[model samples]
Target: MNVTFRCPPELEQVLPRPVPAKVGLPDWLRRMPATAHDEVLGVELMTVKKCAPFLDAMGYGFLMPLACDLQIDKGRLSWDWDLPATPGETYSRSPVALHAAAQVRGSPFEKGAAPMLKFNAFWTIELPAGWSLLCTHPVNRTDLPFRSLTGMVDSDRYTDNFINFVAEWIDPSFSGILPRGTPVAQCIPVRRESFDYRFEVMTQDETDAFRDTRDSMDGTAGVYRRDMRVRK
Candidate 1:
């Protein structure tokens, strides 16, 4: 599966290149040892198993990093993304005003969801045939100030344009430089296929085996890695 980034010429020098999740793993996670998960529970608040899975979910695809540090002034409804394009033009749109939740509908989860705040996208991604991209907030990162709304694009069939990380500026009080290379979104490429859903109960023998294995492996830390998970 080839996923090409159609970087506009102007952004080549300014935009931080999108990279694989492994390359940009949060510093805290880097110190974690998969073998000695018990010791890491205090600071991380999660067993290695729980934390690993969350990263696994988000780390499956490439991450779109912030092209440049964005300095936003919520009080003034102003911002700056220094991407010099063509002589006089800049890359980003004007700082947008945040909206109140009462002005919109539905129960929103993100911190900035109440306000209809949006910005322009910087790049266009070209996906391979029969593939679509799922754009979502970087996984397992509740620390980020703003929350990105999830969306899907059929990249395979629609290659004429690119996509953006249109998100809510969750932190209203946060007014400063959001350093360059900060991840704004995660893009997961999914193969398109049709299938039906079905529900079935396990047989008596299957149920017994499941219970026995679970009981035997309950205290083991790497059961999924050593016993159940298929080696990629």
Candidate 2:
């Protein structure tokens, strides 16, 4: 599916454009050992770096990056940008905005925390008809100091304005600068649909198939990767 990302001409030269998630895989993932020795098992065990499913999940979509560098001191956030405004067009000048704590009162993110932050988006996303954008935190990025709240936008229909991201400030003591182009949201296009649910017990044949698959996987690395995984 073709997706469009539009921004002001002034921002086109300054702001970081979204990137393919696979191209933005975190440094930790690349540095991790594929297999580590396990003293308890007396053998080497494959780590998440060698897990196709885990790696695929992290590389499944596009990454929305920070428009500018944001400095976070204690719990405060600030940025420095000299953006030129568009004639007769209004948009965010900063990289982030604020959401009053009262807006999330009684919610899990509240917890007496200071105001939540809304990431000021510079681009407007456009998707093909019948498809929506699922915006969530970077997959498996627990190292980040903030936790992005998940949201869904029907980009197929709503493409006029920015789809900003709201996040809870998770680490008050974290003091550092989040550089420009740091991924703030991972977006996946989803088709609009409804589905019915079913619960069932496996038939004898299904059970046998399951056993066969499990047996093939046991004590064997890359069984699923070699035989079942679909290459992209």
Candidate 3:
């Protein structure tokens, strides 16, 4: 699915600033030297696209966090993989490690019909300092077609646990209803095959508006699109 980000001028002013800093103390400290930064900056804008099947294979459903982790410096965009050095190796870049840190913050389990699940996954993209924007998407798919007893998570809320639940659901191994020991590669068989799926983006403001409408008592009449195939 191809997802894009559009930031409004007002919101773009709140982004964090990234700066290079030292990571080691004096000789007495006896610690290895490294580099650390609190945030990423110098990002004017960003655009990202992820294949649905590939993302399912990678055990994730969303790339917002991953896209956020990307940093643009000068003219090149770089992803900072905060990795630890091995005994012999000087450095390493693990996408998994970077992913683990990009999770949202909050519980997924609410007090209603929609149950919640959690998984460990995260991604981020760095923009220029003091950059904030009202992000919106041209297309947004709140409802995706899949067969399972498990209820879908609320995508409107960008909580950590919520994001994790989405990841594990698409992951074959972690799927609560699936047989144990299923290889991650085989999780989304339908997605693996030639299946048609679409993705779109919703700006932060737009998402808020949708949620507001959905939250209203009169809004219980929800809408969904379904395309099912049955074998005889």
* TM-score versus the correct structure, for each prediction: 0.78, 0.95, 0.18
Predictions in order: lDDT:
0.68, 0.89, 0.26
Q: For model 2, how does the per-residue alpha-carbon lDDT over 150-226 read when each residue is reduced to its tens digit?
A: 99999999998988999987878889999898888999999999999999999999999999999989968799899
Query: Stretches of candidate 3 above 4 Å error?
Result: 1-109, 112-115, 118-120, 133-138, 145-232
lDDT string, candidate 3, 1-232, tens digits: 2222233233234322211111111132233223223346643221212222222223322222221243333323344444434455321232222222124234341223322222112212222333222221101221211111122322223222212213222222222222111111111111212568988799899999778766762433213111121211
Q: TM-score for model 3? A: 0.18
Task: By TM-score, rank the candidates, best first.
Answer: 2, 1, 3
Scored by lDDT, model 2 comes in at: 0.89
**Which regions in candidate 1 have their CA more than 4 angstroms from the true location?**
31-46, 49-51, 73-82, 87-114, 230-232
Q: Which candidate comes out best when scored by lDDT?
A: 2
* Best candidate (score: TM-score): 2
Q: By lDDT, highest first, what's the ranking?
A: 2, 1, 3
